[model samples]
Target: MVGRELYRLLQCPTCNSRDLAVYAEYVLCAGCRNQYPIHKGYIDLMPRQTEFDYISKYVSEEESMGEELDYREMAPPLLAAGVRHRQIRRMLELKPTDIVFDNACGNGRFGLWNADAVGLLVGSDPAVLFADQALAEMELAQADSRRLPFVDGAFDKSLSVDVLEHFPRDVIHDYLVETARVLKVGGRVAIFSNTREMSPIQPIINISKRLGKFFVKQGVYDFEREARRKSDHIKDLKTWDDVEAALVEAGLKPVKVVFWNSVFTSFVEHVLMKLGESLIAKRRTAKAASATVLTDEAVNASAGAQREIVARRAMRRHLTKSSPIYWALYTITLLMELDLWLFGWMRTGPYFVLAEKVEGRYVPAPLPAEE
Candidate 1:
């Protein structure tokens, strides 16, 4: 589909030069000679790799583990009502000529899920292996989500799922600014992630760590490591307000904001998750009903009691190490999460956001006077 007139008529997204030319299967910027590979039928215009936050190694390991523990793949039942997925589906309704950007397109999860709908699907990620995987599966470029190589207003719509929460609050603004720069006027971006309050395990994990060593609690904090690995876990997470403010400051109008996956659904998920884990454990335990015993409430309750005792002793060791601010914030977050889960109002699977790029006069810089 990318041919001579198509190549000639299209300017370098980076340089705005009609001097673009097509090579073996790529479009090159005539001014800079930057080669943008054409995978399948789409051109990748990202410049350098540093634009992504570098998660190749982690994602690789995850992919391997994901295969072994196919349990994670069963989440769509819980996420069928995801607001973010709905938003992406809505974006797919745009005209074929409209450009679309899939940021942090890890393994092209969302891109491939909606590929046939959008016209120009540009997928980018930091990890070479991840990009490699995407290219192998569908088509994606090696580019950073943070610093996309596209020219201003390159895409008519963009979508990022399960990405924003992992970044530090400071980096989020840059992400939003970059998204705004790449999207054309009236372009929309839908982001999906967990709100801080929605996850109760975080505070519990932090508290357990502070007291784990001296208190010697054996298994109470078992889920901590697993919880951190979820895409929503952040070193310094943002509240919903902070996220909204960042989007607004980046010159994108907030159209819709919805939260999903609160503790209610979380409880159900946890139970199913434990069932999955038991399936793993029983395969190794023995040839007897011991696995059944392990699954029973009596055994689980006794274990829970022992854990509480250890936790009580351990917590005593860290009596002075309390953060009132963190506790208050997290508690509120928890309450909100609980409300979402129980009331079923705010507990949408994904926070579906619709944002439009702010349009204004594009004043070109004055040309240099002749010497």
Candidate 2:
């Protein structure tokens, strides 16, 4: 039954045809006669030619970088993918029978975390490594977000976290339109992304980055790769109003908007990150200088040990009844929560927009007349 349902949702990317049949390990489209292979439990639906050269390069880099880090350990508690997933679940009122689509699901963290709660979870990403990671828990496909291969109205909800900003400015609207096309009428979509308004803590972060660079010169830090990672944000959204306008133009009705991660929380998290990275760098430098041979297993065990120590410290801090720092952080968090409840639409840190697809044929917004 599940396999039949999955078959029904798939369509030919070239022809947008539903005349599809499942062969041994390929989905064949009778309309275009295109055969898409199923590899490692994921259907490869990526089109042969992409609209932009940058898209392919970006996806390739993402896949290559996937082998470098353990995202679960590096993610901070304040802005973790789990944190975003919980917010999406609450905002969309996700139910056990809900069919959810996670568009541009890099690493598939959100989908994997909530797969057990939803009836069907499908994750689509251009990066094949992300699909490979998600295949254990949910149906995954290697496809562009702007050209999803699913049938219209196939999903009950769609969620995208920190994905829109990576797209070129010219194609963001197309991505939203595709998001609406795959969702059922009145189905909700949630998007979380960084805005153009720099958070109050951003200046401090910049200062820290400079300090980090200086430390690198002194052999106390190494952040050259991290510095290069910042170039991925090709399209930082300017404002929440712009986001809402894009959704409305794409045939989705805006439902709820909220901002979170206040200045205080961000500052604290930055400090923690800097401290952790410095310690790790120091250890690596010492090991290298001493010519100490460390096996991959040993290195992984050390990282795991460090993560456990940090987790224990975090737990103890939260549990401590009379600690001043704990109370201060708690208060700051409460204020941020209140700010979201009171003034989410106003410019703040990262913001979320929840919208529902409107019924009717979606007419693309007309291009502006020539001056």
Candidate 3:
């Protein structure tokens, strides 16, 4: 099991020393005399929280709503998330004997889903809690990605999703350095995050967003609420070239690059699915005894719990295997994947990338120009 050699991979985030003492209650750092508390199933390795300029929703919102939401019932590799996760898995090219790290592993969504397929999974994030299923299947840690508490060349491979947007150029290179530092030589890491540019199919996305706003005009997907959520948090707006340059600087050579958030994903998720969820939330509000509609902020704040309830129900239907709805969803997911095939070559919007750790300098390969 991964536990047998887990300490071999871990180090002190403060002092970067591997002289750690593991105990029933905590892991003690010999160099810094810092004790990391082991609770619920994850080690808290977040550095001085005050130094952080941006706070993740996982740290702020999810922590408060933890009591009402059972992470064990949550599904990560389903619906829209599944689209990104599928591409990530393909980029990772996982192996049964490889030790993998899920960096920025929010709620262990991908880790929990792919745990059985790999030898071991170590999910780390700043503040997100792990599901019971993940605790049973993988090691969970609360660590900052920029300063991971892991020894150099610790993992065979890693995957990070939705992390690049939060890291500005000033900080993102540090994160990439840490990422490359933890991977073994020639080891590959899968990355899924966005650039600042518009997608090749931006017009289609415009149409989809407009359709959703016009038809499902509801509190759940309000524009102002979304702006409030993303305006500050998504500060990393570098171009693909800038990101690739940084990756090379960190000794990680990008081997494969494919983009997402195009025609299929935008229409299916932004328009169709949002439309359905908005309608459902509206009906639920109307059926309330007081018949009071929630404010936009309330709708956004409670979205996690609401979606989980729906996910749990869908999980039951999926477990049936014979249910027609299960196949319906399966088919829709497959259909969504068509966007990857259609738009993968185009360098635009969010992307899934596979990069390997190399010793020498890495030269950038020019992707086919979109023009």
Candidate 4:
């Protein structure tokens, strides 16, 4: 991907000053005199050189242990994709010429999805692996999300998907403030996260996580397996309240926080996770016994089988018995879908909460009721 025009998108990460001068790869902050250097076409915007614990733990250059793990084959949550992309496109409706930032952009997939609408797309992540993944998909600069290498209020739109949970609760406020700082006045941001009250699957997933960790402790699993299965730097499990509070504290106007619900999202997520667990187990044993180099085709085949297993589990969950809480959650989710259908939002999405930033404050609007 070609880098967007430097003059239009460059900003001082610390002071948010437009008085930035760029030469080759270095951007100088006129206000603070802080120097942000560019390396390999990506800028380093961190405040100080400190180790990113999460990146160190989760992203590493090692072969994945396929044993006792299976979530790899699952497609991203369909509902999430629809809602997130729709919100991104909608930001265009709010402001067509906004510079957009995808914070902690894992692989540049979201940036690619929204590439056409935004005036310019900037994706930043601390992990080199994520940057590599993003670069593989499209040209993106390597930078830190916390200390962005752009001017204050330079961007008209920003987004972070499933990223806040990775930080400790105390520091999440700082992240939001930084997000607000980078956004232009009256800019909008879309945040997608998993809330504790949002679904019952959190507990189930947590239990599975513990079980997987137990296996690792017993020497049945390895580091790669753990990294692939669980995140290391995630410090908080946010609920709707926490999300709203963070947004408010950050000084961005909260327009809406819509709860999202869709069969595709839930189904794809559930099935893929089940399969990931299975594949991890299978790979562990298969690799140990075989001395031959593993081919991409072989890995894909393993992932495909795991996908099938996830699909099967999804069907079973919908048809078979579950806990009372699950039934309640399912019923509520179904109701949310029905509401979406009545309002003609299902094709686009449901459970979306929209927010707008006005006068350095977030103003949230109540979710539209089913028509």
TM-score of every candidate: 0.58, 0.76, 0.83, 0.60
Whose lDDT is greatest here? 3
lDDT of 1: 0.52
Q: Per-residue lDDT for 157-257 in model 2, tens only?
A: 98998887776554687788899999998899988887677554456446645655565577653433343344577554476666777788789899887
Model-by-model lDDT, in order?
0.52, 0.66, 0.71, 0.53
Residue 207 of model 4 has an lDDT of 53
Instruction: Kindly list the per-residue Cα lDDT of model 1 for residues 250-359, writing each as its tens digit.
Output: 78778776555444334333333333333444344343334433343323333333232233323223333274533443343344345334443443334656677878
Cα distance off (Å), candidate 1, residue 214: 21
lDDT of 4 by residue, 1-371 (tens): 43646456666656667787777767687888888776664566665435544343333522332322332222222233545656545544634475788877765667666766656777776653333334544445556666666666767787777676566654566567767777878777887665445343334435545654565566443344324444444536345655666576667657765455433344434443334444544554444423221322224324434333333334334432344634543554444344334433322222344445558344433322322
Off by over 4 Å in 2: 1-4, 49-56, 67-79, 131-133, 199-226, 280-345, 367-371
Q: What range of 10 consecutive residues in model 3 has the weakest lDDT sum?
A: 289-298
Question: What's the distance in Å from true for residue 60, model 4?
Answer: 8.0
Q: Model 1 — which ten-residue stretch has the worst lDDT?
A: 69-78
User: After superposition on all CA atoms, what RMSD does each candidate show versus the true structure?
Assistant: 13.4, 6.1, 5.4, 10.5
| lDDT for position 287 in model 2 | 45
lDDT of 3 by residue, 112-160 (tens): 7777778878889886567666666678888888789898889999988
Model 1 bad stretches (over 4 Å): 1-19, 25-27, 34-84, 87-98, 128-137, 198-228, 235-237, 280-350, 361-371
Clashes of each: 5, 0, 0, 40
